[model samples]
Target: MTAAVRSTQQVFNLPDLGEGLTEAEIVAWRVAVGDVVEVDQPVVEVETAKAVVDVPCPYAGRVVALHGSPGELRPVGQPLITVAPLDDGADDAGRAGAGGADDPGGEPAGHAVYREEERAGSGNVLVGYGTGHGPAGRRRRRVGAARAGTGRRAAADDTAASTAALPEGHPTGTGAPVPTGAPAVVGDASAYRSRLDGELDAPLVISPLVRRLARERGIDLSAIRGSGPGGMIRRADLDARTGGPAGDGRGAGLAAVPDLRPAATAAATDAGADAGADEIVIPLRGVRKTIADKLSRSRREIPEVTIWVDVDATGLLATRAAINAAQPDRPVSLLALLARICVAGLRRYPQLNARVDGERGEIVQSGRIHLGIAAQTERGLLVPVLADVQRMDTGALSAALAETTAQARAGTLPPARLTGGTFTLNNYGVFGVDGSTPIINHPEAALLGIGRIVDKPWVVDGALAVRKVAEISLTFDHRVCDGGVAGGFLRFVADCVESPAVLIANV
Candidate 1:
C-alpha cells in the first residue's frame, strides 16, 4: 500500500465580533509562531466598532503564521491565524491515553497524538473561526498528490482553478457538489471572464448594502454586470453605474458607512483624492469612527424631540445625604439615586423605555428594564448596560454603576455588557453642565439627561427660599410616542425628584 496522506494545516478566519461589524483593527497577538495553544485560548485582541474584545482560537495546535500585525485592519472572514493540527492517523489507544499526567484534558507528554474532539472549543461566538451566525464547518479540503516541482501552494491553486473551470452546476472530479457558503478564493481570470460574458441576465448580489443602494437609486441590480467571483455584485460595480457622484452628494453620505465596510477606508479614499501639503487629515477610526457613524445615523433616521423641566431636588438630595450618613461604608451615589427615580418613572410611563422598530412597524415595549449608563473614558464615550435594573435596590444599583464605570475606565468591559439597553440615563452633570439636549442613543427610544444639583432660589410653600434644584431633559423618539407621553414621563420623573416620598411609594 502507498503511504497515507494526513491533513494538517488549518487557517482560522476572523469572526464577526457582533453588531454587524465587517472588520477590526488587530490590537495585539497573544501567541507567536511555533507556540502551542489550546482551544478557546485568546489568540488576539481586536478593537471592533463596538468594543475591544479578545478573539479565541478554536483549534489546539502549533501556530504556523499570523496574517496581520498590531494596529492593522483585517476584514471579517479573512485569514487570522494558521495552525498545524495534530496528526489524526495515530493509534486509538495513543489518542485516548494522550491526556496529561496532571489533568484529564491536559497535554500528554511525549509523542502521542492529540484527538481533535479532545480539543473542543468554548462554544462562545467570538472564536476566530467562522461567522458566528452560520454552521461552523471546518475549512478543510482534500487535495490530490503533488506533481513534480509543485508544493502545497501549487496544489491549492490547482484545486481552485479546477473548481472555477468546471461548467455551470457541474461537480468536482470526485462527484461532490461545491461547498455552500465557502469563501470565494482567487480563481482563473479567463474562466471568470467567460462565465461573466455568458451569464449576464441576473447578477449574483449578496451584500445588503448593494441591495439597498440599488433600491434607493432606482437602478436595476439584474441589469448590472458583476466582476466578482461567481458574478457577485460589488460596491465598485454600483459606484461605476452611479458614475461615482462627487463631493457631499448621495454617495458622500455613504462614505462613513458602518456594518458594510470600515469607515476609515472610505474616509481615507475620500481624503486620498485631495491630499495636499496644507491639509490636516484625521482618520475616522476606532471609538471616534464608531461615535461619528452612530451619531450621524441617529440624526438622520431619528425624529427626536427634546423637552426640559426644572425640578426642586431638595428632597432627593436630602434622601441621598441621609442614606450616606446612615451607611457610610455602603453609601449610594447621587447619580444612582437619580437613576432609581428614572426607573420608577419608566414603570409609570413604559413607552419612554420602549423602542420603535420602524422596519417591523411596531413599538417593542420591554417588560424588563435594562438601563444604559453613559460614561466617558479615555478611549471615548461608552455605555455599559445594567440588566434588569428594576430588580436592583439603591445600594446594589450604586455598586453596579460604580463597577461598570470602573470597568469602562479600565477598558475591560465586555462587548455584551455594552449593548441591549431598553433605556439610557446620561449624567452630564459631572461636567458641571446645567442642561443639554443630548442625542438619544439609537434604538433606545428615550434618554434622560441629569443636570447638576445646586442650591437655587425656589418657591417653597409659596415663599421664595434657597433649595436644592436641578434641570432634567428628556430626548425621545417622536415615532415611539407623542409630546403628551413625553411630557408625562418627564413630569413624573420631576415629581419623583421633587418629592422623594413619591419614589419610595412607587418602589
Candidate 2:
C-alpha cells in the first residue's frame, strides 16, 4: 500500500463584534469549500445586532468546511470556518471525504495545527477577532497514520451517544433515524464535548445566568430544543418555554390573572382547534431582534418620566430659512439645528447626558456628547452616532448627519458607528406624530423627541397669531436626576425652539 497522507486543518472562531454582543447572524458566504483564500480575505458577511460586517479569515489556505449556514446565528468564540494547508497533498475528493460521506453529520476532523516557527495569521484585525504576528510558543500536534480510523471511530461513538440521549421512538426532527457512524450536528462545540465526556444528560448552555435561571425555576433544560444557532438555548428561548418574561418569574403567576375579554374569548371559541391557522408568526432576528431586546430591557429597568412642552417654532423656522438663503449651496437641515440645540441643552444640564452604572453604583458622565440620531431604515430603527458633537458646528454637524444617515439607510454603517452613544435625539416628526413617550435607548440617560411642526394659533405678545408650533418631549431616566433637572433641560430646549436668539445668546 502507498504511504498514508496526513492532512491537518485550522479552525477560525467568530470573534467578538464588540459592545458586549454575544452572537451574529451569517448573512452570506463569500467563499465556499475547496476555494482558496488569502490571509485577511473576507470569507463571510455577518450581520450583528448593530451592523453588517465582513468577517475575514486569518489563515491562508483552502477552505475544507464551513461551520454554520446562512441566516444562522453564530455565537462568538464558536468555530466559523475550517481551512486546510495547501501543502497537504489531499485531492478535492480526499478533502471532501475528510468529514466522511458516510458520516454526513460529522464535523470535519482536525485539530488546529500551526507551524513550529510561527502561527499563520492575517495580522489585520477585524473588531476583536484576528490572528496576530507572534512566534508559535507551543509544539504542533501531528495526527499519526491512524487519523482516519480514529475519526471514524469517534464519529460512530458520537452517533451512538446522541441516539441514547433521546427518548425511545422520538423523531430526531428529520423524520428518520440518525445514520450510524455519523456525528450529531450540534449547536456548538460544547455539545460535542458533553457527548464525548459521557455527560449526555447535561444541557448545552453558554451562559451562567441562563443556567441559574433554569435551576431556580426547576425547568429541565434537556427537554427543550434550543431555537438559537446550532440548537444552543438562549435566555429568550427559556422565556418562551416557561411562558414568562425573561429574568423575571412574574409570568409563572400569569394564570392567576383573570381573562375579562369576552369578545376575544368568543372569537377564540368560534375559531377553536383551527385558531392556529389564522396566526402568522414572524421570527425576530438581527436588527429587529436587537431592537426588541433593548427596548424591553429599557422599559423594564428604567423608571422613565416623560415631560412635554408645545413650542412656537416660528423663529427657529425663520432662522433656518435665513441661514439657507444666505448659503443656498450649503443648506442646513432642521434636524441639525435641533441637534445644535440638544448639544447646548446637554452642555447646560450635563446630568441628562450621562449613564447609570448600576454595578458600580455610580453615575457615569461624559465630557463630550456622542450624539445618537435615530433614523428609520428598511432594516429597522438604527441610531448612528456622531462622535464628539460638542466640537462640530451646525454646518459640520449637518454634513456629517446627512452622510451618516445615508449610510445607515443603505445598511453600510460599521459596528463602530452604531454604538457609544451618550445621548439621543429622535426626530419622530417625520412620521407625522405630534408627540410620543419614546423609550430611552438603554445605557443612555435621555432622549429628546421632536414632533411635527405645523401652523397653529399661538399667543405671541398676548395676541392670537398663526405660527409654526411643535411639541417637544424629553424622556429621562429617573435614576440620574429628579424632575427639576429633567424639566430644566426640556424648558431650555423649548426656549431654543421658540426663540433662536436664546440659543444664539448661549452659543
Q: Best lDDT goes to which candidate?
A: 2
Candidate 2, residues 1-507, lDDT tens digits: the string is 013433367789998677778999976565545445667766776778887656777787666678897668899999999877666645333544564533333334442222222237945646223343221101111111111423322444444444444433334422356543222323333333334434544555544345545665567998878775345566567667755443345564664553333322322332332233455344688887888998999999889999999999999999999999999988999999999999999999999999998889999999999999999875678899999999999999999999899777756676678889999999998877799999999989999999999999999888999999999999999999999999999999999988889999998
The per-candidate count of clashes, in order, stands at 0, 1
What lDDT does model 1 reach? 0.68
Residue-level lDDT for 219 in candidate 2 = 72
lDDT for every model? 0.68, 0.70
Model 2 pairs whose backbones collide: 187-230
All candidates: TM-score: 0.59, 0.61
Give the Å shift of residue 143 in candidate 2. 40
Model 2 TM: 0.61
Give the range where candidate 1 is weakest over 10 consecutive residues by summed lDDT.
Answer: 136-145
TM-score of 1: 0.59
**Which candidate should be chosen as best, given TM-score against the real structure?**
2
Please write out the lDDT profile of model 1 over residues 1-507, one tens digit for every residue.
Answer: 112312455688997676677999876565545335667666776778777656777777655567987668999999999776554443222333454333222222342443444366556656322324222111112222222221111334435643543334433524454442222221222222223223424345544345545664567987887776555676677667766533236666776553322434443443344332255366578767888887888888889999999899888888889999999999999889989988999998898889888798899999899999999865578888999999999999999999888766655566678789999999888777799998888888999998888899998889999998889999999998999999998988898888889888988
